[model samples]
Target: MANTTSAKKATRKIARKTAINKARRTRVRGCLRKVEEAIAAADQAAASEALRIAQSELMRAVSKGVFHKNTASRKVSRLSKRIKALSA
Candidate 1:
């Protein structure tokens, strides 16, 4: 339990931030799932489009501190490679 007023305020702030972070993470996951679904269906066009949207969502998460830059880059790289393979 937070004994001090400032500590209570800090706890509230953390909870709000946590909620925002969770929402951002969820959004990123949903975008990635869309890409994965397109890939699994072997639809090159849909996969390409999904990857585009996922990439943007991923970078946004990175900028918001929900994901590390390298983690986002790695995800984008793997998804792009998979999309390219679908076309090939």
Candidate 2:
């Protein structure tokens, strides 16, 4: 119920941004899932590779404002720790 023209335009802009951010979030989740799957399967090499890709996707999301930098960093750190533990 946006009566003002500017308000209508803002609503449209918000919808567009929502769609884009949703896609980005989905992509990031997919990457994280891949890493987790690799880890669960205990495949060190695959986990490492997946983590590499996930790390980049996470940072990309952070840059796009889909995720906070610290959140992404924490995810990357935890994944790295798990991957390293596989070596032991």
Candidate 3:
């Protein structure tokens, strides 16, 4: 659907970026799932570690423009609260 030369090149770049962004999102989701599972299993230590990892991944997503900064912050806040509640 791209007609101009630069448009065609931009389209290609967009496709590549889409793959990278998708992978980043998948990894973030996996990290979050790990945290959730650890919390569900009542493993406080593991849940804390997993939360750290998931938070890092979410921040990375924000830096890469895959997520908004506020969105990542909100998720991190909620996840941290859940992890804290597991201990309390």
Candidate 4:
């Protein structure tokens, strides 16, 4: 239990932030899943488009601090590489 008023306020704030972060994380995961599904289907065009949207969502999550910058970059790199491989 929070002993001070400040502690209670901080707890509330943390809860709110946690909920927001969870939502952002869920959305990012959904975007990644979409890209993977497109790639698995072997549809280069759809994969490319999904990758584009996923990249944007990933970077946005990074900007919001939901994901580390390097993590987002790595994901985008791997996805792009896969998409390129599909074309080749």
CA-lDDT, candidates in order: 0.94, 0.96, 0.94, 0.93
Which pairs clash in model 1? none
Model 3, span 12-51: residue lDDT tens: 9999999999999999999999998998998999999999
Off by over 4 Å in 3: none
| TM-score of every candidate relative to the true structure | 0.97, 0.98, 0.94, 0.97
In terms of lDDT, which candidate is strongest?
A: 2
* Tens-digit lDDT string for candidate 2 (1-88): 9999999999999999999999999999999999999999999999999999999999999999999999999999999999999889
TM-score computed on alpha carbons, candidate 2: 0.98
Per-residue CA lDDT of model 4 for 1-88, tens digit only, reads 9999999999999999999999989998999999999989999999999989988988998999999999999999999999899888
Question: Cα RMSDs of all predictions?
Answer: 0.6, 0.5, 0.8, 0.7
Runs off by more than 4 Å, candidate 1: none
Tell me the tens digit of each residue's lDDT in model 1 across 1-88.
9999999999999999999999999999999999999999999999899889989999999999999999999999998998889877
The TM-score of predicted model 4 comes to 0.97
Q: On a 0 to 100 scale, what is the lDDT of residue 27 in model 4?
A: 91
